[model samples]
Target: MPKHISLISLLVVCSLWNMPQAVHAQALIPHTLQLDAENLERQGLQLAQEAAQLGQFQQFDLALPRARLASQLAPNNDRVWFLLGGLHLQAQDVDAAMAALEKANSLNPENPDIFFALGSANFQQQKYQAAADHYKQGLKLKPDYREGLFDLGNAYYMLGRLPEAIAQYNKSFSQDQKFWPAINNIGLIKYEQGDIESAMKQWRTSVEIDKQAAEPLLALAVAMYNQGDRQQALSMGEAAIRIDQRYANLDFLKENLWGERLLSDTKIFLELPRIQAALQQSDN
Candidate 1:
């Protein structure tokens, strides 16, 4: 795995740096009982930094022990609890993540980031309402949080609240126009609502924004095949898979929120000799 340097580590380092000289000495040395507490806090921050570095590379197994130790060493430190929460969340230990994050939130409820991480954990657990609620709270704290908006949109989408989902996606786009996931998700809603033309337009615009993005390209190619343009569809489909081989599977397509109509159409398209040959050729 690639070595990682996480923002959590930087933030911890900065926090330590910002301390006064006297406290810094106390944090480093074990001269007295009071100083020992400071020393433990400093050690916790170090352990938290190590956990974050490992977590960044998806080594949650290795990261979790360090995060736990950090939290134990500095029970009052919100950042230490937050790191534990993040590690648990990454490892899909939703219950543990929520517990740690709840502690972090109690320590610093004003931090919108804790709510966002809670929302993400809820989302992964398929608790859409909880996710939406957490996202709403986080967004209220920081209205321009683009990822929070997008995630709220996803929660709405999962709840079958299409219009609300689109509204959230549009809000995200307003904040950062180049956010391709919002554009792509809007296409998903449009396609599901039987607006193929609008969906195509969105997908095309999405592809224009990021040529190597496989999501919209696959959607466009499937739409093209459904519209009876074999050669163009085959070429586009080939290009889509070339950009990301994961797009070649039905499960992956469904995960992208391709509606049943499009899924059925794509299944038919993929069975064509031309599409198979072209996709096979591209793999080589």
Candidate 2:
């Protein structure tokens, strides 16, 4: 199988393994039975919010059942399903997240955040085409939805439609110039297309926009190294390592640019032969 496909499959399997079972019907019961259902629902929501704020993902997982019960108690409140969907997303239960988010969307179709979450779940699951369609629908509903545009650009990028990716990134950046990921992704696409100068310019702009981000620094270094500017490349590469020692593909850069500095960087050396083969297969 193609490497990326294999990798994705492996990730899916691992995620499935780690996923908690769908909360059983019995699990949705509240501890204290009360006639004042609205008050009980309000208390359940408050607990859910507390769990989310504490970053207690497992607690959030447990809290979702109560939230759903609360929704049952107060069938008219849209916030109950919205919170349930957000909690399911935090739990990485995509199917449940989609269901709850769709329910929330039905209640509040004009809510851009619901579409954004649905788009995000699809994107994470590698349903690129579906993600793009959802993002497009979201943008249609809310023209300045920067998150939708950003994620839509990501879907296009993963599909290897670089021009479309760039257009989406540009649209996202127009809404918020400080959107570092889009800027970094634009640089990445230019680098992949062999436009080293333009790539470096974009990466530099990205770094200017978000000084703490390591991606633009690493990408700029790679672009510089590819263009034979070893000194500047080493400088930027070292800077990136200092910012985020665990930056992805740092070892790949070091290996490719060996006989130069940054050799001691403790990043994973991506096998180029494998990468090239995967790219070739993707093109097919």
Candidate 3:
């Protein structure tokens, strides 16, 4: 799963009276122009906050420009760079995001979040080893960071390190019991390894933990179908699609890391008349 860089808690709340003169300046100013670095940073923080707020409203296109302006106005501020990187990442521009985050990391090596951001950027780009390294460094700075632990598990999974992935996923669960994805992903690993019983158990546990999640429901349904429990399998699959119609999509199923055998079974399951009717009804 990709991650978003969170805003820092230390932003100084500046009123209109305290707004820097540069707030009225061009969106992307020339670096050679004389400007107070401190004032620029303060204004940039405000702009970054606005950008983050826009993201909360799902106004990503509106947010990116503000975040870019913040980075330009406060070129030396690590937080602005991080904000810029996060906006890019949210927009799925991995290369740009990684470049901005690398700058943030260089500006403040002590900040664990920078490493976490870099790890997520690399992960999205399918650079699993690089992601693992960055997540490791972030975990070294803050051992209990559950997001880092969970994502490190994802990186390990992509690298075919099943044991290491499960370990990291378990660590994430220990840190935050509400995080059902960790347990759900462990089921995925188990399924990939052909441990069907254990996979079922893990998926059941995940479903109990988060009934609303579509992944475990769909996974459990697939496992059931593979086991010849057609009625139960269809029921679960229907429930999964009722919760989220995207579960019917073959590409989405594959993206969830379904193995060849399981995916083959799923393709057959999808061809079933009842399953096709359920999907069609959901689409309608």
Best by lDDT: 1
Go through the candidates in order and give each one's C-alpha lDDT: 0.85, 0.68, 0.84
- The order of the candidates by TM-score, greatest first, is 3, 1, 2
* Candidate 3, superposed: residue stretches over 4 Å from native: 1-36
Candidate 1 ranges beyond 4 A from true positions: 1-31, 274-284
TM, every model: 0.83, 0.69, 0.84
lDDT of 3 at 129: 99
Clashing pairs in 1: none
Each prediction's RMSD to truth: 9.5, 15.9, 9.8
lDDT tens digits, residues 14-128, model 1? 7568865546545543344456567778988999999999999999888999999889878999989988998898888999999999999999998899999999989888899
Q: Which of the numbered candidates is closest to the native, going by highest TM-score?
A: 3
Model 1 lDDT at residue 82: 86
lDDT (tens digit, per residue) of candidate 2 on 96-169:
98888888889988877777788878876788888888888888888887778888888888777778989998
TM-score of 3: 0.84
Clashes of each: 0, 0, 0
- lDDT, model 1, position 1: 6
Instruction: Predict model 1's lDDT versus the native.
Output: 0.85
